[model samples]
Target: MFDPFKDFDQAGYLRNLYGEKDPQIVRGLEHTLFRTGLDEALAHVAKRRTLGYSDFLAVHRILFSAFYPSAGQDRAATVPNIAVSKGNTVFAHPLDARRAVEEGLRIGQDKAALRQHPGEVMGWFAYGHPFLDGNGRTMLIIHSELCHRAGFCIEWQRTRKTEYLAALNAEIASPGQGLLDGYLLSFVGAACERQLWGGAIDGIRGLDGRSIEDAVDGEYTDVRVMQKYQAFEMSRAMSKADRR
Candidate 1:
């Protein structure tokens, strides 16, 4: 069996990926060394480096800054507040981080008991908005990780935006019926296919006004790329699920 978590040397991977001379990479290395104790963070950085996927806008910045805050700051500062949205509905109430963490752990550990469906999990977290920042990216990472661990591969690359959005909307509107689970399973199936096919399938497109095709064309292509990407995603998902 392939160990997804094996040999994750975070510092080395970060330095290599961002290039040893890049200031941002240097700062990220410094921050990780100083702040987080989580053994997986560096591994995630390495995995992402292998995949060539840039961090989602805010999430990337937060990750970098956490390791390298302004001059006098002790650690990356906590985000001020988080706002969650479900289509037209939005909530600004304070999220109970501890409660969210506990629930996340429960969801991950008791996958069989919950017979967990993706939409409920997605809705629960999206609505919960546990982190002050990185909610969307974090949710995606966490959800993907659980499905992968459970023997499914969620291919965000192949997921139709309309379907993905619909599942999210359904969860926000109804919160039950398992709509998200079905959609996520389909996505997993697609991802697995893409992995087997070796880049014949187009990866995620339409993020940040760039299509997946364009993103791939603009960067390096290697078989290990998507594998690494999947690993990073799995890490995020597992981490979140364990928190609950």
Candidate 2:
């Protein structure tokens, strides 16, 4: 479990005290549970008046709090330099994260502008890299809401990971070019209600400078103690929630 690359932040993902390093076991244990939390976040966000930067943090927190202790916290305090897993793209520094996200929200908070230039807003969120983990999923949930509010939804299942990721890399490099927009435009379909989120989030779409498909189709090795550990984690999260 001491694998540096997968456990870059050293979050200690193993179910054993001996540190059994298996990313698949870790992912399998969390995948189904994360989807559950994502649904909860979607429902919570929908009840709000308008979306903003805070919701970005809230979504990440809700989804990953069951796994990571530092789920929703921003990286500004430590200011870690982030490297893209997909490419050599450089993300924005931690100091600039808050301002960058705020400006993006200010511009795209209007549903019309967000739909017209979703890539711009996306670029801003991607660059911020607010959470240490779950960056992609957090943005996807919030962005989906914005798109639906603007009268359309991205047909994410139709788009190929490689194609969309390449465009995303280009957008990250350029920030505001139409590369990602053009790619997504073709897959633009009617709005999808988040209420019917049965399998909407059960895809390999939580990509952010990382391999999505590989993460989803993990070789689930036997981790018999994983369930016990997960129960402990859920209790921990519930305790934290109660204190709050």
Candidate 3:
């Protein structure tokens, strides 16, 4: 029972071709990957991205291709069971991941779905704990797109990580309550237009890696688990008109 959170460098930094040990070198390379990849990720957002589950995977892959081989793929696809936490907060069970994401996408399609029930929707996606790394950063883009489609956006720069994460943890721990919604709603500001996308989203903050994992079992993915996600689309029935 080796705990990865307590274990350092569980997934070795990909670009460490020479087995470099300097923390500065590792941090620099990781930031470089994020800065360069963000340019492409912003471009995808410019075209009115109504993300399906595959698009969700694509966003992670697109942003972290330079860093990890498991970038875009969900943990369920590779690892069987994972334990993810942030400092002292732990995410939901791996077994419910597929159904949780399917539910999140379904609710996020509407114009004000996020505004109305931000807690539930945000909790579901966070609970799904889809990516082994870069979940927060990738989801920020996806959440922003949903906000943009809904005719608004979060003032991410204005959000303090302390407050946002506390709220997120509360929501994930208690699914029905509106802890996250209340905290996030006050920070809702004007959407960043096309010219501003790059400046707004291009940074190291997105690469913070909020999600962490512990134990990994190989027997978690069975027929029942796979079936829950078989018909999972980006949304329930969202149209181009609805997004606008």
Clashing pairs in 3: 52-234
Deviation (Å) of 155 in candidate 2: 1.1
Candidate 3 TM-score versus the reference:
0.73
RMSD of each: 16.3, 13.6, 7.8
* Candidate 2: tens digits of C-alpha lDDT, residues 122-196: 777776767655677787788787787778888787778778777877766665556677787787788877776
Which residue window of length 10 is worst by lDDT in model 3?
231-240
* Clashing residue pairs, backbone N/CA/C < 3 A, model 2: 1-21
Estimate every model's Cα lDDT from 0 to 1.
Answer: 0.41, 0.63, 0.62
**Superposed Cα RMSD, model 3:** 7.8
Ranking by lDDT: 2, 3, 1
CA lDDT, candidate 3, residue 104: 79
Question: Which 10 consecutive positions of candidate 1 have the poorest summed lDDT?
Answer: 211-220
